[model samples]
Target: MFTPEVPFLRSSATPIPGRYVLVFDSAEQTESTSIGLRARAEEVPQILESEGYSLTEYFPRLGIAVVSSAAEQLDEFQARCASRRMPTRVVPEMVYHALSAVPTPQPTDSFEDTDQATWGLQAVGAVNSEYTGAGIKVAVLDTGFDLAHPDFTGRTVVSKSFVEGEDAQDGHGHGTHCIGTACGPRTLADGRGYGVASGSDIYAGKVLGSDGSGSDATILAGIDWALENECQVISMSLGADVQQVHPPYVTAGRRALELGSLIIAAAGNNAQRSQGNPGFVGAPANSPYVMAVGALDNTLSIADFSARTLPGRGGQVDTSGPGVAIYSSWPGAEKYNTISGTSMATPHVAGIAALLAEATGFRARELWAELVQEAKRLELFSVDVGSGLTQAPPPAEA
Candidate 1:
């Protein structure tokens, strides 16, 4: 019931007119609220049957409800929610992008260059690892994937779309490219080898839309679905810059780790300290429980655009991976494209996580500790690369 005078995020997605989110302290409270709401449906004239607002969905597990109202009805709706002891906010639709596409690359003479087998695969030593992540379930939560991509033929892939009105198809190329790196085939039909966990089962969750963006609710829903399916590793190559970590993402990450799923996210591409302005790690990735990944170039140096961890703050970049001039799957006539950002770097860790999972039975925190311990130490500060670059486990036979 305590309404803080915090302003809506300036860059948060625009409010969908009249839509809001009501959060409760616990699932029991949410369920009780829902039941009480129904019992007093007639008394609450402002909501149930009035011109004020209407409930759309109630997710008791997450302790939230989606409601729609008119501009004039918002104040009354919030007051009523507060009176009912539920903290309410006009759900500011959060916009997330495929991190690889962030900071908007400048137009170069070779903008159309396309290649295969990114240096990231080599940088992480995935090229030499004998483990193919066989039997492990890896989830890539991003824009929907191209179901018809020839490179993924015969792979055991399960897909679901969280984007409203969109099917599980990669109209935007970001998801396809990330999936290509994390779970694509090892040897290409064209005789090129790219992906790391070529033999792992793929659970493609389309949290973003064809435009390469999605709201927080949609993303939360996707995360819930992925965890419910018990995927071992969830790769999120999408996020937005937010100094403080969002509460919902923190809760969700904790729940995921408890469920034995590791969520890895991109550190953001807003840094340009050489220009005297550097950005901090973005939310979801910034969550203490989520593993935040930064980008490195082929030479193992931090990418110019990769965000560094904020001093004594929540949004700290955890690990580094190859991100610059990276080539992976794309959509349509162009089967591949070279892109950059912490987004591209994240999947390398995800794929390697799958490999490590397959190599050992470590789950959640234990797996995370092993990954950091096995990373190659670098001369950079811990904030730039927590444990240096992630390296795959040696074959069990070794």
Candidate 2:
């Protein structure tokens, strides 16, 4: 009984030591009857336990498990499953990083923050949208958030940490910035607006630690929690540089959409188009079920670092967002900061997704369709910008 390791397109991604992700096919898909499905589900845990693997976490809803074991022990378990024709997939756990890149020099553009809103709000038409994401739950799974940020003073924000030994507080500023872009207050103390879904509930899940890195286990847990909470929109501004679609996210994203939650993720920032290098969309984002977002500058141009779509299924960019020189919230006394990357772009799409959800009562795939249909088609190539810049639905659409 020997099962081959899950194959991925070659890239710099390295698997975590002694950690693996196990995915079980849904009972409905693998078994012909409910009773059979139940029996197989029950037996999965017992089989893992007997195989000398430590079951670190089990997400029954997603049929995903994170396990720790010696390499040989995992091979034996995989072989047993293969011999029994168990429809299970075993992949080495890999680390993902926050998608934010170092801010490059600002482009020559007249769009800047005004008393009404930041450049991003203006670029995406969030300023004129009639709908605020009221009552909609938007989850941002990232490095955490600044609970004490003044702009979030009165907002309803529920937070939890999936990263071990860390609270939901954002030690790194990336998560705070993303949350602000997605669900910050309508008007800050200075009377400037940054967030899009100003009225949406915020669910901040700290999947990445302070060092700005997280393994697949923590990320999957965050997605599971977001799904459990029934969030309509889940924003993930993180990914690895692997060009191939990861199997775990394939299941996670598909199941999320089926459950009425749309997972929006960064398309990755590994490109350097100025140097003639157009990077490909990476894992999680490259999964077909997940909506991949590329980055756009204020001039409505694709950012130099924005990844291009790769050839084949699940490797295309689905949309673009205001990413470069984007202004948003920060932690502690910093209060505010301006940065760039597909990370900044992702929340713009998430916040807009919230608006569409509130406006059209659309969830999951429909919400995704509306967002793409409403995008302001840019002059860039489709491989880079997808349906072009994401736009907020106007009053008429609402």
Candidate 3:
């Protein structure tokens, strides 16, 4: 089998229901990659080696950092890791971190999905494809959020923070952007926001804390929480460096599918284009059951930062979306902002999955198959955009 190996750091421990979080450089925020690569990722093996830890997983690309939910938790593990002197980050378990309210702007039409929006319109259609995800539960696992965003006013079902005992409201601003893309109020062009599943109830899990960083334990806990809630579809805007799955996290994803949940993860925002690297997809995003996604620009051109597959890979990216400077709701329902990343793109698929599940009345594998089979190939018509994106009517059922 493909047992991904990690250093002494435990891959995944107990399935603690919590938030899906990220641990990025607080100094490095999620912004459009107009220039250099914004969210840089790489394997953490160097750090582990320095820490005197042993690794044996088949996929070390899926490196994991040891973390504890308790205060001062994992101190020894961290110390061990610290001894390595490698740059490392820990994402708190995914959960919601509510931010102070941001004043809502009178709805604008800029964020609307246009016919020219290619992948963007398809996403709208995907959400409307089944139903508005009204009854079906959808989870957004990403960076911090803004609870005060007008789009999410009071619709957030459950907001929990696992960033080492942090609040569930968004602080990093990433969670809010992803949420807006997936299920925010339809208010973009003509008042339609970037949301795909307009009516679906969103549960914000701020796995990436205010600093946009988190540990593996936090991610596992967030997954566990989604399972406990029986979330129909989960959208993760975060990605890991390793190609293999995190020990327990991999198990958790499989378990989620077995329990009838579908996942949509980001293909990553690495500038493989500039690196002269061909095939480079992110982990967790690259996991077996995940619906890996890529990003595009306003003109429907693949985003320069979109992760690509090596030369021979048929479909490195399952689909693409309007990730370049995509505008969406921020936490605190306060204001509208622009951000980019496959992170922004993943939610678009999640919202679509929710709609598909509700409309088709299929869970997990069934829903996943439907989405994949139906995805328009991004490579099909560069003119039409990749995987042409998805368009589903509000699901027939929820």
Candidate 4:
């Protein structure tokens, strides 16, 4: 077996001791290694222990399968090489039905801009009958939303706020805007543009306070809530400055993925040319499993204020979206608001995922891989731009 001088993990949720992750010298090696999810946290040690391995880190909400950094295990797995992707597949309880494979969009004409119906081309061409977020439940982990918003006409089924002293009301307006971009009713008229996925159900996970800022504990709690709620798509339109990832954020993101939830976060807007350089990709967004997004201009150009990448070759960000003057629904009366940042760009993908999840029925890693594979790779401003824009690929021949 060829050992690459590093530990290995079957999945991101499996906790390993120390601030380390299982690393493969090459993508091919990662393909050679085995990856699986844990069916039950209780049986983790026994399953690995049957192989003389022990668990280091544990994310119960995600239901991860196996986690180890022991060099010998990695070597053994490498010897049993196979496809570019892992062969082993560990599974948790199939709590919810798998998203349907065929495209099944639930179209509506009179609802608010849940499908992002006002942005003209951006919303018009973004969805279709096969691409609406039909059965997927999205957890909007932000400030509380007005469940009575016309855009949210008949969309909300679950809502909980952890912003101590705050009720189910959106004072900051950030969460409402984020939810609208991801999924809302048919309010916009030009070309009938609205949210990218109109059929998706939004769970108002009020973590951020009325001021649009939240604590680490609140964010973590919201993650747990999403997992328990069986939400498939999670969109975080808020972010903090701080180039590196924090342990708490990493744990929460990994946990969300374990629960079969696709995680998306704003890459943050700090540009780094000022004193209060709040441009660094903050917590949760810094997590690997979470798709950290940057921003772009109308012509698919990188946003000037978008956060830049680190000084590493592979550290290039995951993707980018239209962040400049991009418009979407807000918390107030039937209306829309133009916003910027990876925050604005995040819902584009989140909405797209709802559409794709409605089409392909891919789980967390699967959805992420498809998103990247179907993305437009414009690595020009690798730092601030990340992986250019994200949009659906042209329809392939039947």
- Top lDDT: which candidate number? 2
Query: What does candidate 4 score on TM?
Result: 0.67
Cα RMSD to native, each candidate? 7.4, 5.5, 13.5, 12.7
What is the alpha-carbon RMSD of candidate 4 to the true structure? 12.7
TM-scores for every predicted model = 0.81, 0.92, 0.66, 0.67
Per-candidate clash tally: 1, 0, 89, 24
Name the lDDT of candidate 3: 0.56
| Local accuracy by lDDT, each model | 0.73, 0.85, 0.56, 0.57
Per-residue lDDT tens digits for candidate 4, residues 25-128, read 22222211212322223443454557665454343453333344455564564344323332232211110000001111223442123343443225224644
Question: Alpha-carbon error at 95 in model 4, in Å?
Answer: 33
Worst 10-residue lDDT window, candidate 2: 1-10
Positional deviation of residue 65's Cα in model 3 after best superposition, in angstroms: 12
Q: List the residue pairs that clash in candidate 2.
A: none
Cα RMSD of predicted structure 3: 13.5
Compared to the true structure, candidate 3 yields what TM-score? 0.66
